[model samples]
Target: MGFLYQLGINLAALLLPVSRFFSPKMKLFVDGRKQSFAVLENQIDKNQEYIWFHVASLGEYEQGLPVMEEIKAQYPEYKLLLTFFSPSGFEIRKNNKIADITIYLPLDTKQNVKRFLDIVQPKMVFFIKYEFWPNYLYELKNRNIPTYLISGIFRKNQLFFKWYGGFYRKALQSFDHFFVQNDASAQLLKSIDFNNSTVNGDTRFDRVAQIVERAQPLDFIADFKNNTTTIVIGSSWVDDEAIYLPYLNNSENVKLIIAPHNIKEEEITRLISKIDKKTVRFTNYKTEELKNADVFIIDTIGILTQIYAYADIGYVGGAFKTGLHNILEPATYGTPVVIGPKYSKFQEAKDLVALGSCLVVHNTEELSITFNRLITDADYRNELGIKNLEFVLKNKNATKVIMDFIERNI
Candidate 1:
């Protein structure tokens, strides 16, 4: 199995150039990695000790942020090297201020793994969430460097639990500890006979809770809100728009801030054409026009979290279309959230829905009814928002749990 896995890695490396022509994302996946080792060679300072964090994408980056910040605070002497396996995370946050250096993770072949570990020589390594590259884990273990899985989650049906999963299970042995999100994940690790695990909650809650405490005010958003009820639709796709756009177009005396997931010119233009109400986009809009418009379309990136602070209701997109985006961003601000029906895969969405703090709608009719109730009944909306806020507050100490463990051992 290990031999086959190595073969698979080599095969992928060979095919990456051939796959680049398939899509722009694929091109990024191929081109960005070409510079990975060189970036490490140039940026890594052998004189300074380093701590490494690896995240799959932007969501995992967020999951890793609280711990990263804590580690930097407690150990200021160590430089941080953050690596991403996906372009979505690296492309957007490559210039982030947290990491001393950020680059793409070299592919998980033996040669690439050796070069990466050789260049970085990280004092501590953390794989956020479920990234378990077999070659990388094995090599890190061989070097005797401490590796941990932060906010780890596991399910019974995974390959690691199957009968012919000895190779995969061997990869799990590399981790010094497993800071999992729930009891089920802890139990699954135990089933595999890897007992170095703890049932700490997800670190994402701590990330959002910190954002709420340190949230900065946005004047333009306040101007557009115009002292009226505002619905912030975040990361919406076309299908998600289909569920709520009609209600937004027909509704009156309310403000809608819709930030589509894809902000390409065509996507933004098509969304603007569908709305019959007065609309002002973020890139080029006057405060006067923004104050007068019914809908505010954010065609740019970043600042979504600060905008959520002003929302009475938040419609997070992706459940009906591509995948579910973050609902916790808005929920952290005490905003009642609504999303499409396909949210079962998202644990936070499930928890919020079960608590009656988040609403799930199937179609335009259901979305309309949900919006009307939320708009007309301020007290009920406030109650739901409070519940969501309370839920976030309750789950916030996960970072402390993780940091405490690291302090005792690291």
Candidate 2:
């Protein structure tokens, strides 16, 4: 299995240049890693002690952020080096203030792994949810580094739990500790005879809770809302817009703000053409002009958390297609969240549904009906919103829990 995994990694590294021609995202991926070693050699100071954190993408980075920040606060002497397996996370957070250095993680071949570890010389390492590179884990363990998997979620379907999974199971066992998000994950680890695990919940709840505490009123959003009930459609994709656009276009006395998952010109134009009502781009809108518009399209990123503050109801996107985006961002702001039907994989989404704090809609009609009911019934909407906020607050200490364990053990 190790040989096959190494062969696959080598194949991917060799074929990455060809993939760049077919996919722009793949192009970014290949391009980002081209100078990774050079970047490491140039930027990383061997004299400075470092704590390394690895995340697969933007979502995992957000999940691991609270713990990273707490670690930074507790050990100010240690510099932070963050790495991303995907370009989406690295590109967006390369200039982030939290880490002293940020770079794309090199491909997980033994040679590359050794080179990266030697350069960073991380005192401790953290792998965020769902990122398990066997080679890297093996190398870290060989060096006797204290490595942890934070906010880990495992399912029976994963290779680690399968009959022929001994090689993969070794990767799981490499972690000094597994701070899992739920009981099922802990049980899965235990089933594999890996007892170094704890159910510490998810650190994203802590991050979002911080966002809610620091949330301030956005003057432009306030002016645009104009005291009317507002529905924020955050991180919407084409499929999500297909289901909810018509209802938003025809609805009256309520404002809709869309922050599409992609902000490319073509996508923005396509969304605008679908909307029947007068629409204004966030970048182009004036405060006085907002009253005449029924739809507002956000052309920028990084403000979705703050946007949730002005939302009476939130429709998080992505569940209509691949999966669900972050519903907790809206829930943290005491807003009732609604998403599409395909959110079974997300534990928080399932828990929110079970708590009656989140509503699931299958199509345009279901979304319209759900929205109409929530918009008309203020008491019911507020009740659900309060429940969502409480749910977030109740799960707020996962970061502290993980940090406490790290302090004691590492």
Candidate 3:
């Protein structure tokens, strides 16, 4: 199995260039080494022990960030090297201020892995969530490096439970500890006889809870909302827009802030065209003009979190599809959340729904009805909002728990 895995890795390396033209993400993979080199060169003078954190995508990055921040704060002597496996995570976070080094994880081939370890020599490594690259884990174990899987989750039907998954199970065993997100995940690991595990709640709650404490005032957003109920549509996609556009048109005295997932010119144009009312793009909104507009489209990146400060309610997108985006960003603002039906895969969404902090709609009718009721019933909205905020606040210290273990173990 190990030999075949190595062969597959070599094949992927050889074909990476060929795949680059066809996939935007493949280009990032091919360029990862160069990006890593630049980060390493910039950090040559840094005099702190390095800790590497690898995340599969933006969601995993969020899951890992609270713990990473804690490690940096508690052990100022530790330098952080954050790596991403996906472009969606890397592109947004490449210029992030928190990490000493942020780069794409070099492809997980043996040669690339050896070069990465040679260059970074991270004292401790963390694979956030379920990123269990067999070669990387095996190599780290061989070198006696401490590797941990943080905020991980496992379901009953995952590959590890299959009869042919011994190799994958062996890779899981390489982690010195597994910090799972829930009791069910811990139970799953225990059922498999995996001993080094703990149920440390999702660190994303820790991250979002911190956002609430440090909420920065957005003057433009405040002025735009201007004492009216505002519905912040975060990370919307075409699937969500198809259902939300009609309802947004009919609503009144309510401000809409649409931050589409992809802000490409074509998509932005389509979004603007769909809305019947006076619309202002976020980039072009003047202070005076923004106050008058009923709707605003956020065409830029990086303001989604701050925008939540001005939101009275939140409609988080991506739930209309198979994969859902983060709902906690808006929920942290003490705003009731509305999402589509396809939210079963997202544990937070399920939890929020169970707590009455979020509502899931199937079609435009349910969305319209829910939106109308949530807006009209101020007391009900306020109650859900308060519950949402309390939920976030309650889970704020998962990072501290995980770090306590890391300090003791590492």
Candidate 4:
């Protein structure tokens, strides 16, 4: 099994270059990692001690950020090294100010792992959420490096609990401790004889709460909203648009702001064509022009979190296609959230749904009904928004708990 796992990793490395010719994303993945060793050697100080953090993508980075900031504050002597496996994470956060060095993680082959560890020689390592690189974990373990998994969530259906999961289970044992998001994850670890786990809740709650506290006012969004019933469709996919576009086009009193997952011109153009009413891109937005537009399409990034603060109702995207986008972002702003039906993977989404704050719609009809209901009933919307805010407040402080544990251990 170990041999097979190594072979799989080797195969991926072997085929990455070939895959790059066909897929731009694959090309970015390969190109970003091409100078991994060179980047590390040039940037990392050999004499300085460091703490390494590995995140799969931007979402995981957000989950681990509060803890990383806390570590930096307490141990200013240690430089932070952040690594991302996905191109989306690396490309978006390459200019991140938190980490002293940010680069694409080297491939998880044993040799690559060994070389990476030697270059950084980190005092400790933290793998955020769902990233499990077997060779890297094993190498860190062999070097007696303190490694932890933060904000991790596991389900019974995952390979670690399956009948033929020995190698995967071995990978699980490489972590010194598991700071999981829920008791179910802790119990799942217990079932596998991995008792070094704690239900620390989710650090994302803490991150979103902080965002809410420090949310800067967006004057453009204020000008666009202009005291109308504002519906923010955040991180929207094509499927999400298909469901909500009709409602947005027909509704008169409400203003709609869409921040699509892909801001590519073609996609944006396609979205604009589908709408019957006037639409304006965020980049070219003028305060005077906003009054005439029914839909405002955000063509840029990084302002989605702050935009939520101005939202009366938020329709988070991704659930209709993949899984779901961040409902917490809107919930933190006391905006009643509406998501698709496929939010089973996110416990926070489920909790919000149970609290009657999040509305889960299965199709266009359901979405239309839910959207209209929230729009027409101001008191109901306000009540749900309050519950959503309270939910975020209650689930926070996971970062403090994880930080306390790290302080005691390290």
TM for every model, in the order presented, reads 0.97, 0.98, 0.95, 0.98
Q: Write the per-residue lDDT of candidate 4 for residues 1-410, one digit (tens) a residue.
A: 88999999999989889999999899999998998899998988878999999999988999989988899999999999999999878888999999999999989998899999988999999999889988988888889999999999999898889999888888887899999998999999999899999888899999998897888888888888888998999999989988998787778888999999998889988989999888889978778998777889999889999999989999999998976988999999889999998899998998899988999998888988998899899999999999999988998999898888888988
Ranking of all candidate structures by their lDDT, best first:
1, 2, 4, 3
The lDDT of model 1 is 0.91
lDDT of every model, 2 decimals: 0.91, 0.91, 0.85, 0.90
True-vs-predicted CA distance for residue 175, candidate 3, Å = 0.6
Candidate scoring better on lDDT of 1 and 3: 1
Write one digit per residue (lDDT tens) for candidate 1, span 1-410.
Answer: 77888888999999999999999998999999999888888888889999999999999999999999999999999999999999989998999999999999989999989888988888999999899999999999999999999988888888899998899999988999999988888999898798999887788999888888898899999999989999999999989888888898789878999999899999999999999999999999987897889999999988888899999999999999857999999999899999998886667888999999999999999998999899999999999999999999888888898889889988
Tell me the number of clashing residue pairs for each predicted model: 0, 0, 0, 0
Superposed by TM-score, candidate 1 places the C-alpha of residue 72 at a distance from the truth, in angstroms, of 1.0
Please give the lDDT score at residue 28 for candidate 1: 95
What is the lDDT for 375 in model 1?
94
Per-residue lDDT over 299-401 for candidate 2, one digit per residue giving the tens place of the 0 to 100 score: 9889989999999999999999996899999998889999999998899999999999899999999999999999999999999999999999999899988
State how far residue 302 of model 2 sits from its true place (Å): 0.7
For each of the candidates, the C-alpha root-mean-square deviation to the true structure, in angstroms, is: 1.3, 0.9, 1.9, 1.0
Query: Which ranges in model 3 have alpha carbons more than 4 Å from their true place?
Result: 1-4, 37-48
| Window of ten residues with lowest summed lDDT in model 1 | 341-350
